[model samples]
Target: MTATTLDAVTPAGAAARRPVSGTVHSWDLSTGVDGPGSRFVTFLSGCPLQCLYCQNPDTLRMRNGRRVAADEIVAEAAKYRRFIRAAGGGATISGGEPLLQPVFAGELFHRFKHELGYHTALDTSGYLGARATDALLRDVDLVLLDIKSWDRDTYRKVTGRSLEPTLDFARRLADLGKEVWVRFVLVPGLTDDPANIERVAAFAASLGNVSRVDVLPFHKLGEAKWAALGMDFALRDTPSPTPREVAEAREIFASQGLTAV
Candidate 1:
């Protein structure tokens, strides 16, 4: 739904013209889950993966979003700037894969971190991590990286994408010494394999830059959204992981000498 307009004269014809625009699903304020504290989270639209457990199925496509300029998003966040700062939270660019609109995401980070002096985070699957420029990473204070599954085929079954790209991106983030919080969903039948959990734990531990690991238990909260979108909810019968399973998965990460919660 978002389109960039180029001048007929030249690419840099207008200084007043917005430098970047993107498809935005929505924005909200959240605490505890998104980042360090309270966060002004902007959910950009468009994702390459078709993760069966994706909660925001409505954000799967670009056309389903509203076209907005980066300035508009930042200005909205400015209204909550004082409150966010007081809570020890900041701005986070989340998505249907934030890297899908790298330029727009980068601009948001620049404005939020440099201009507003707030902590910035990117919540991404890292499927398109290659799209992130060095400058963009420089502005990001934390990365909420989703490592869906560790087994290659299981990853594909869960997300319909290759697992290597996410791993490659994690390594890249490690090399940059960027702060990261690795997020993994515990699906009772699909992703709870002990070996898979161990692989994910080991990989995250090897990163050396990972600060925390969040073992999120999967639920059916998004089934209605999928039903509304007329899409198949493949994991409808899948149950949430039991407390013991969740605790055990967390223990796997702890065994790797990584903090898991």
Candidate 2:
């Protein structure tokens, strides 16, 4: 993520009750992995990063989504309150990068908390974490932070962006005692290096607020999307890490005392 990822909003403003609007790519009532049990997940549109493995390349453009109002989303989420609450689940504002529509996302999350009385989570890449202010985070019950890599050069190679911004965001979240679920992708011959994984584990361990770590195995699931978008599928030659590799990476996080899932 880059500063441009959050080009749609700035930090430091108090969240308002008005009907703020944003672009949405899609949504689903998902379970298990998003956050907690089951969730009413809203996928916002636009992202600045060009991660070669992006599964939803269709959602990467800022101008390609339908504009939606926060109240509409809140109303939709409210309808699912009974089922979601019973499942120990909540609402998640995910995206190509939700921070891109900061005001809209903040308002939706605030409503989810104060109005619906449900858990609110932000599934983010933390590239735009700098744009998430205290007021916004205040309403967020959890943050599923995807820390792609720990090495600076390796990070740039992986996501085509700098690493400092993400770390800065993670530290800020830590300072606030926010519950964080760290997600790292394990790609063979690229991000599967043990030293790199260890570094990530060490940093997450230092945070003292990370509740869990998810070591996701790399996959070519997005290959067809890349072809459809006329983007080169660079990972055609890059293999997904084997099951053993996934286990080893999880072990590394566990060794650092992180709860690996």
The number of the candidate with the highest lDDT is 1
Model 2 Cα lDDT, one tens digit per residue, 67-90: 776778888888999999999999
Query: Candidate 1 — which residues are off by over 4 angstroms?
Result: 2-17
lDDT of 1 at 34: 94
**lDDT, candidate 2, residue 24?**
86
lDDT per residue as tens, model 1, 1-261: 543321112111236644567789999999989999999999988899999999999988888898887778889999998899999999999878888888788878988997788999999999999989898899999999999999888999999999888889999999999999999999988899999999999999988999999999999999999999999999999989899999999999999999999
Clashing pairs in 2: none
Cα distance off (Å), candidate 1, residue 190: 1.0
